[model samples]
Target: MKRQRAFFHTLRLPRFRRITLPLLLLLVFTATSYSLVGRQTATVPLPGLVMIDAGHGGYDPGVMSNGILEKDITLAIAKQLQAALQARGIPTAMTRDSDIDYADSGTKGSSSKRSDLNKRLELTEIQQATVFVSLHINNSTLATRGGAEVFYSEQNEGTAELAAAVQSELHKIPQMSKRDAKPGKYYLLRNQEIPSLIVECGYLNIADERARLNTADYQKKLAEAIANGLDSWLQKNK
Candidate 1:
């Protein structure tokens, strides 16, 4: 019994734990480091970078109707879209991740908006992005219009195809009425340097549509649709 007690006491020594703890930590660290290194080496590079623009942030709340602000909705969708793309190993860059605009607050509102847009244009150029998607919610004095629409610049090559690809997936959403992708002369789209599109996710003027757009579940669906469209288009082009 004394021998057994002595052995058990030896097992409980502080020195034993100090030695064993370091060994255990070393083993864990080695395994984790190896796994991370393997993953980094194995991961494939994306076909190209994608630029995501969340429309009308900061001072520009965009189209506001009822209680819904278009800026909030666009930002929410843009965040989700960015996550969805990143999860698929695609690289993405965002113009504004927060409520603030890209331009200095001291500037006049019109100049601020222009400056914000110019900053976005600069980012697209600097990154040499393969394509740019701008998220927006539509509104009108007439409260009856509601649907997902994609707008592309006629001057930009492959924008029509990009718009069509995204619109097709968005149409799958039951709440969204099918609308054809159309030519738009919007400032964002008219940049012919790269393929660019403005996606009007839904009409905020319509009560039902506004409520749906405000929901997280619906925002996720919209993000997924956009991601799918982008993946399809990119794969085909590759």
Candidate 2:
């Protein structure tokens, strides 16, 4: 029994954590709150609810430029983000996964964007979601405009903070440039009660950025960055 206690005491020592077993464990659950031994003891934030909106779908190309569709990029990033979050054990729901359309008018797609967003809010209320993130792409006449932008609604200060958290992490990646978090009028951010953010991954007008956004590798990096941001925010909040 004393030997077991001595072993526990050794684990409690910081020096022991640098040893082989502990170091390997640290690699297994990188960035999680718990040290090497935390895998089973602590809960990963992934179990919490997050709504991932893939902007545009079906016939709606969203913001189209240079033959690239905003819908496609958005879905790609959203799905990638979903995979990243799930890897960390975060539960996520997608607003749309396929090339379908949800319009701002008419009976078929006519549900007011506001109403549709409000319905998402209702779902969050029921689901107790931790956050809301909408994926989008930017477009401008001049290719000079480039970089990722994060947007939050005016209502939730927490949402803005979360957006900033994500923006900060995204900037850490090698090629990504940081832009300020703007207050957007987007429906998902405005209508949802939970902390919400809209990520403008890049500008479609810029050939380099557009091409970068098209690659699976870049999309994976974006997803990882997003996951890191969410994880950081959750650690602070939780």
Question: lDDT (CA) for every model shown?
Answer: 0.74, 0.69
lDDT of 1 by residue, 104-209 (tens): 5567767877877887787667555778899999998664768889988888667788889999999999878888999988888776477788899999878888
lDDT of 2 by residue, 53-136 (tens): 777665457898777888899989988998887676666766655665433344334454444455445544544466888888
**Candidate 1 weakest ten by summed lDDT:** 2-11
Over 4 Å off in model 1, which ranges? 1-46
lDDT value, residue 68 of candidate 1: 86
State the displacement of the C-alpha of residue 55, model 2, in Å, after optimal TM-score superposition.
0.4
Judged by whole-model lDDT over C-alpha atoms, candidate 2 comes out at: 0.69
Worst 10 residues of 2 by lDDT: 1-10
Candidate 2, pairs of clashing residues? 46-89, 46-90, 57-100, 58-99, 58-100, 105-110, 106-110
Which is the leading candidate under TM-score?
1
